[model samples]
Target: MPLINSDTNNVNNRGAFILFEGCDKAGKSTQAKKLFEYLKNNGHSVELWKFPDRKTTIGQIINEYLANDKDLDDKAIHLLFSVNRWECRKDMKNLLLSGTTLIVDRYAYSGVSYSVAKGLDLDWCCSSDRGLLSPDIIFFMDLTAEAAEKRGGFGEERYEKKSLQEKRIVESSLKLIENCNQLPLKEDLWKTT
Candidate 1:
């Protein structure tokens, strides 16, 4: 687990934004689904959202790129991802403002790192997603390369293979966090592990 940041205060009666972010096969989806079910069963107003929301038109293009069905310029791909997130901004804000807690499976950090891993500029990657929406609490799931490989469907995604520039992925992750630290967002962006 990475260093935890203290929980943030939810002001104005807004719902909590709980986010699960990590590398491939880190159990982010499982944890997020379980948490969503738990909250729902417990009668909390909640919703779950995932980035690269493949259901949308922009997301379809993203899916094509991720699936290797099509090729795109690194910057073009990054912008598409940013647009994917942007499309949900209004609805997400409405839900949160209406006191509906949102359990987000993945967010801008993952997209930024992926772009950086592909050799895009860090600031350029982050710029498109700037002030999108900050999570009240982020669960950063960390898994070793071997452990991640042991799980099923490990190599299904383009970035899943370790022998294929995994170092860049790790480096990009570090750069993502470092760049995030530069922005004066929430001091307590990190929470319990």
Candidate 2:
């Protein structure tokens, strides 16, 4: 027989999914870490996740593919990135169910924004990430491409080229601003504070 007690069996409040989105050099990593530590110190169970989670096997392949300019079809690489997210979906779900807050440095929105920013259809880009866990809050960190480039040493990665990154930044901003404005809340797409 099973223990039968409504008081004991009641579900506790689950964790929140907070996502941070931004162009390169938006200082998302630094702020995310700070927020995670603050939450943990306050006694909340928390998990910090960075997308393109480059430590996993799939991520390793993606990293190599991006680093060396290894040629792959646009759709192929896009799908691979999406699959990477799928691979982690179960874990994210369990973490939320277990009442542990998950802080993501980047989530599906990055995939859509960057890919579509390359000229893929915005609808298509968004479609790829549909049905994944929707975040309770998405923090978009905004910065101008010029400011990001001025930070220097911009060629550390494949996507670091100033010109291309600028295009990405512009397209991503338009997509986010448009989408967010239509939401009922209608707050600024990035940097609430």
Candidate 3:
């Protein structure tokens, strides 16, 4: 993978904010953790962060919603997802300013894309996440819906199913890449042994 450094005005120059985004079972968490471990092992400061943290109040609601245990309005859930990230904004900025790289499993892109797939207004979804920290480099794991379905945990969560909806989510994710630096990862490169 190509590692792209960030250009920032922070006193310490700040650390790179790297993000991994893709459909369910696309190995975002796995690759993010691996990158975090690699950076740490090399004596660099690094952190691995995931969305819907499931530990905070907002995240708990998100967790329940994802599990299909609780029903939520589309706008409500979308805002909650954005709020979940906002809750971490301070700490994220602090870590980066302190020169610690962050390997994130997901971010605003997922929130906007998934919600938009459900027929929400794209502008509205994007508005909720304004002023969030943007990633210095985003790695889009380009996995087809068919390929993702064959992986484990394909149908356990609300968004894991392979369908036309998921295809749209994947397509929507591409929209976020246009103005940002991208490092595309082919499926073969991410396959587990």
TM-score comparison, 1 vs 3, better candidate: 3
lDDT per residue as tens, model 3, 73-132: 999999999899989988987887778888999888888878878888877888878777
lDDT of each: 0.77, 0.73, 0.77
TM-scores for candidates 1 onward, in order: 0.84, 0.82, 0.85
- Per-residue error (Å), model 2, residue 20: 0.6
RMSD of 2: 7.5
Candidate 2 TM-score, true structure as reference: 0.82
Residues 1-193 of candidate 2: C-alpha lDDT, one tens digit per residue: 3222222233355677888888878788888999999999999999899988788888887888878657677777777788888789889877776678999997777777677767777766666666577676788887777888777555677776777677877767556645853223211111222
Q: How much lDDT does candidate 2 score?
A: 0.73
Task: Please provide, for model 1 over 31-115, each residue's C-alpha lDDT reduced to its tens digit, 9 standing for 90 to 100.
Answer: 9999999999999999989987999999999888888888998899888988998899889877877778999988888887777
Candidate 1: segments with Cα more than 4 A from true spot? 1-12, 163-165, 183-193
Best of the two (2, 3) by lDDT: 3
Q: lDDT of model 2 at residue 81?
A: 85
Q: Of the pair 2 and 3, which is ahead by TM-score?
A: 3
